[model samples]
Target: MPATAPSASSAALPTLLRLRDETFDPANPGAYNLYLLASPGRLCLAVADVERRKFVALEEYQLTTGGVPALAEQHDFLSLRGWNAVRLAVTGRAFTLLPSPLFRAGDELAALRLHHTPTPTETVRHTTHPGLELVNVFAADAALADWLTATYGATGRMLHHTSALLAGIVNQRGAASPRRLYLNPGPQELTLVVLGQHLEYCNVFACTTAEDVVYYTILVMQELGLDPEQDEVTVWGELMPDSAVFSLLRTYIRNVRFGFRPGNVQYSYRLNDVFEYRYFDLLSLHFA
Candidate 1:
């Protein structure tokens, strides 16, 4: 007789547990969506639940030089299909993949392997999902990485700052839960995307300067077949907090009603309730 296949329900349960442990909200029933960020250099794992808009857990690693490279190598296995469920292993500076089953054990073990004791780097033994696709990956500039640490490294500091700013705007206009969203980042620019339900058109521009904002907003509106003079456009990101940038953008983009959505919007290994930060979450928001 052919070997019996593992029960789908059993396999799925582990996936669900991994998802929940890594990103779900036990306090909020029915919360499923999550984003995970892993950085081997820092030995940090940041997990955020998009539904509750909060970071559920965070842990750091203390690895020597030998372990750092070990974890960094696993970047090749990072893919979008897993969503927020992932396992990271690091030995010195080297990177390795962990079996997904380990993710189900809870964040404690995940934390231990990632941060505490050094373990032999083991090869991850599992079949890769056919649907998995590498979406967005980029190198963090040394200066930017340093800046992030200085500005938002403390526990709960970044999340609190982000939530307060965004909650105000999202609540003020009572926008219909943002039907469509997109996030794009270049070496020098980061773009936050919001789209209509049909996705007929999209806004893509850099967040660093006001001119780019106005140019992209107009481009998206025109593409969507909406006149900028008549429709409302809401700009969201860290740059929104800068009055000079905001003013310049508003002046150039005339007649259109504009608003600000504040918070840290970088795609990093940190979760913020206020500003959007996870790389996969940004990708999901756009494709969602």
Candidate 2:
């Protein structure tokens, strides 16, 4: 049974941007895998038909504010629009990792509860990545979780944005820099992940300007002992070619370059006109 997409006449919100392949078919929902990414004030989604090896549609919505309430609203909107079985990757900054050996199922919330000073209103949840041998603990608003459970029966697979980003980066096999730094920038946040023989550092920073981007990138490099002139800095996410952030990064980092979509997955020609680096996390969910 194929799922159906909402009609184009569906009510419109304050969308930041929306792109769709001409071949996108609401009648052939079974042909695509849907991926949804929610951040503090933004939501990015992509639908890829792996059987056909192409992306059918993608959207980036700008929320007035991001948090539990915002996520609930966006999630509901998608659900009402007939999108189902959503794989949610949260981009909020409330995640911590634990080794698999140290993780226990009943106490996922307690494992990293101290790390996140969740208010009485928030709830903590945990997801384990056996492949990475790491446990991810994150927080969501209690009300949001309840609403989702009541609305959809349960919160299907939920992943931290960090997990999605790292999975996307590790899944890229071609450009293996022994000691490389990968950045995924968003509205007011920049996620930095360092990779070597193993994962070195992963953290997010709050920034909204070109200078802040450069400052944080260089600061992390210095602390990690990566040379601006020597090591590679690969970036992905929502910046334009002529954008201030891209321009500043190139000026300071010698080996910097934009990242491409994961090599393992096949992209349809519908995505030929779209830049490879954009919607990285959303598209990478095919592997996630």
Candidate 3:
């Protein structure tokens, strides 16, 4: 759809969460980095002060419908540019990671084909993590990729959500940290990542019940020879400490805890009310 004014529904897009620091200046977009997270169910925008390394703004919209083309039409800031930098993280399970030594730029489709069937309207995108010596190859919505190009052009790049999650794992994991599991729970789905010195396993699970999430967590742990009674599991996103998912997760595993915001960056006092562990993927976009 061509760019146009926000519709009545678009203007009222439920703002699930919104925080703007006292220092944030919408007029001075050129001074900050804008990070956008787009998925079928959620759309998020975060702004970081490049000079201070502080996150000055955050806006999350819970979407019952819509896609990339709706983004600029729904939010004026996205249509405007002059951002110091921008990176949009596309969320989906149609992604895979290969070691740098085995990956080639032109082979994204073939690599992703093993795990996901890319649709005709999707475009292949890759982000190489030199520190981890791995390349994440994933498929992004073709319209979303094209829209980013038309709006930001050379000013931005696209990344897979796993890239940000992995970046968070690496940045937060200590040198002496034991083999640990990370769970990022989302609406009707769960993502599990295991870290053993290096990334050992990562996968997304389609789930509907609390039982499904806990069952898969334990199964993956046992399959990987991780003892549920002794191993550590950290969780972030979509669940409260009192939620059924967390309750059941604790029953199966001994070491269970929530995640925290990235320690490297400062945040507005306004964001303190938000759960620390929430939006790990969005906050970690800075690391990706």
Candidate 4:
């Protein structure tokens, strides 16, 4: 999980979750913006009414066979191309962030290589985070990127998955709270972000055990000179309060807590049943 990908491009794929507000206008595609988030694990889409500043629809799906082609086949609004704006984010890819002042236009590949080696089929892209003063450079599926551009015929907002996560976290943290830690955990990995005077650290770690989670958490705290006993850690995921991850975090860190959905926009009552911590990355695309 980007678990932003938490299966198939197939029409037969199960719709894991679908929440729509009565205000959502499937008949008027041009009035709403569409957000598509993809990872090897899953594909999720969200719709927001531009003028109203509210999320009207949220859907999650499994990705498997292919990409993009399914859009033309969807019986729903996803098949439409008249959206006011479309933002696509690819998760579970190789990405690295560099401060804008230190980043030069032509060095996206170099900056990414320092952290990850992209496969031959991947392509390099970069998006600026002016609010955070950082440049997110990442590798996305080459064919998927190409299909999206050719189909849309416009260069819109395309970014790393972490950009959306960072925007949501930064928006949730305020001026008075100078230090914070946020965690987004999936079945096999964790995306951790730490904020000091500014963004102090943000990275995803591959983990297969409860020990891995605690180890990385402590490692980050240790590196940033943060106190596990004092600083607060908020988590956004489907974990139960007594789940192994939470239990270990509370035991070791002493100040861990579950996070809530981003407060930057409004959500439909239909989404109220969906846990606030779930679909966070998909919902945070509103900030993107």
- The better-scoring model by lDDT among 1 and 4 is 4
In candidate 4, the residue pairs with backbone N, CA or C atoms under 3 Å apart (3 or more residues apart, or in different chains) clash, namely 3-6, 7-62, 7-63, 7-64, 8-62, 8-63, 8-64, 9-64
Candidate 4 C-alpha lDDT tens digits along 35-95: 8888766778888888887888888776556655464355355566777888888877488
Model 2 ranges off by over 4 Å: 1-11, 64-77, 80-85, 147-155, 174-177
Model 2 lDDT per residue over 1-288, tens place:
112243444335556656666776655555566677877667677777657767677776766654434544544235433344456677777888887898888776676576677889877887766667878888876765664555445424567778777778777843555878998898788999888867788888889899999999999999999999999999999899899999999999999999998776666555676789988888777666
- By how many angstroms RMSD does model 4 differ from the true structure? 4.6
Question: 110-221 in candidate 3: lDDT tens per residue?
Answer: 9999998888988998999987899999998888888898999798889988898889888887888888889998767788999877889988888899999999999999
Instruction: List the global CA lDDT of all models.
Output: 0.33, 0.74, 0.85, 0.79
Using lDDT as the measure, the top candidate is 3
Residues forming the 10-long window of minimal summed lDDT in candidate 1 = 155-164
Q: Best to worst by TM-score, what's the order? A: 3, 4, 2, 1
lDDT score, candidate 2: 0.74
Q: What's the CA error at residue 229 for candidate 4, in Å?
A: 1.5
In the predicted model 2, the residue pairs found to clash are: 40-66, 54-268
Better of 1 and 2 by lDDT: 2
Residue 52 error for model 4, in Å? Answer: 1.0
> What are the runs in model 4 whose C-alpha is more than 4 Å off?
1-12
The candidate scoring highest on TM-score is 3
Q: Model 3 off-target regions past 4 Å?
A: 1-11, 64-66
Worst 10 residues of 3 by lDDT: 1-10
